[model samples]
Target: MKKKLLVFTGSPRPDSNSAILAREAARAAREAGASVEVINLSRLRLNPCRACDRCRDRGPGQCVQKDDMKKIYPRLKEAGAIILAHPVYWFTINAQTKLFLDRWYAFGGDEYQCFKNKKIGLILTYADQDVFTSGAVNALRAYQDIFNYLGAEISEMVYTTAAGPGRIKKNKPVLKEAYTLGKKLVS
Candidate 1:
């Protein structure tokens, strides 16, 4: 079967650097012959996980709260690969992205085991150009740890520095690298 990729973006700002990178990566994934779906978390009415543990009792992929995440659960399970695109916020992922990921706990327990060995990609944007000093480093590590714990493999991570909206477009190298990372995820 052909590979299916799910790209999720947590940037609330339209035309933000992270959004641009996510869109570019999706285009490249499509060009590489993978089915792609892009989900903008900011546009969705999603709620944070309540930690009720009802999902664990019900079965695999079950959640108690009813919200927009219902639409994402199926796609997430079906996806062969997943890409997360977000701007650095307070040294870590934005609230939207964190909320989305926290819900993945619904798929936990022995009854649910779909997330093993899935390919993962990350596109992070930060205003600080210095990788070490920027909050991006901590964000990247957090993502790496989460993906690793979920039994997923990190295919690639593309970090770009852009201070303003649409500013990343001027950096050809970063754009090219994002596209290449997308292609690599599928191929």
Candidate 2:
């Protein structure tokens, strides 16, 4: 069976560096015979999690709020690999990505079973030269903790400094790295 990859683009801007890298990765994944879905969080109607612990009472993947996130829950469970491609904001993960991830609490009913043994990929870009200065380090650390807690494997991460809109396109190595990561995720 072909692997299915669910890739989330966390950038708010259309055609953003994050989106570009995600699309490149998705394209490579498709070429490598994986089924790939690329979803842009900024374009989705995802509401923040209410911290109401309703998912525990209702069951895993069941959240009270009716929104696109509900639609994503099954996809999350079905996907063999997941990738988050986003740009750092204010030295940390952007709001859009956080909102999406925060909703992952809905899977807590199963103790985050959906993430266990799953392959994970990251494509992070920032406006600053250094990862620490850009706050990408903080974002990576958070991902490490989350995936580690869930027993997922972080297979690849491609980060770079793209100081402005479309600047990431000039970074050939990062682009290739993203594509390579895609191929590896499905292999």
Candidate 3:
């Protein structure tokens, strides 16, 4: 069976570096025979999780609020692999990304282990040349913890440092790496 990859871009700017990289990766994934779907969080109307523990009472995968996230839930559950592409802000993920992730609470609870055994990939872009020294490392670690808790395995993580919009295009190595990661996902 062909693999299905669901990619989420957390950058608000349509032309942001992170978005570019994500598009490139998605293209490569398509070329490698995987079906790909890219969702830009900036264009969606996703709200943050209220933490009301309503999911538990509703029996998992249930959110009280009906928003754009309702569209994403089914895709997420059906995907064989998931990719998160975002630009680092203040040494962490952007607000849009955080809000989307927090809403995953609806998928929590023992009954909804739908995320288990799924593969995850991360593509992060930052302004600082040394991401480890720029506090972005913590953001990467946070993602790791979240995926681990969800019973998903991280197959690849690609990080690059570029300041201006579309500057990531100048980094050939990173672009190549992103493409390679995508191709690997279907292999």
lDDT of each: 0.88, 0.92, 0.86
Rate residue 35 of model 2 by lDDT.
96
lDDT per residue (tens digit) for residues 47-94 in model 3: 789899888888666788899988888888889998899988888887
- Residues 55-75, candidate 1: write the lDDT tens digits: 888876778777998888888
Span of 10 residues, lowest total lDDT, candidate 1:
108-117
lDDT of 1: 0.88
Per-model TM values vs. the true structure:
0.96, 0.98, 0.95
- Once superposed on the true structure, which residue ranges of model 2 sit more than 4 Å away at CA? none
Worst 10 residues of 2 by lDDT: 162-171
Which residue pairs overlap in candidate 1's backbone? none
Off by over 4 Å in 1: none
Candidate 2's clash total is 0
Better of 1 and 3 by TM-score: 1
Q: List runs of model 3 lying over 4 Å from the truth.
A: none
Candidate 2 at residue 26, lDDT?
96
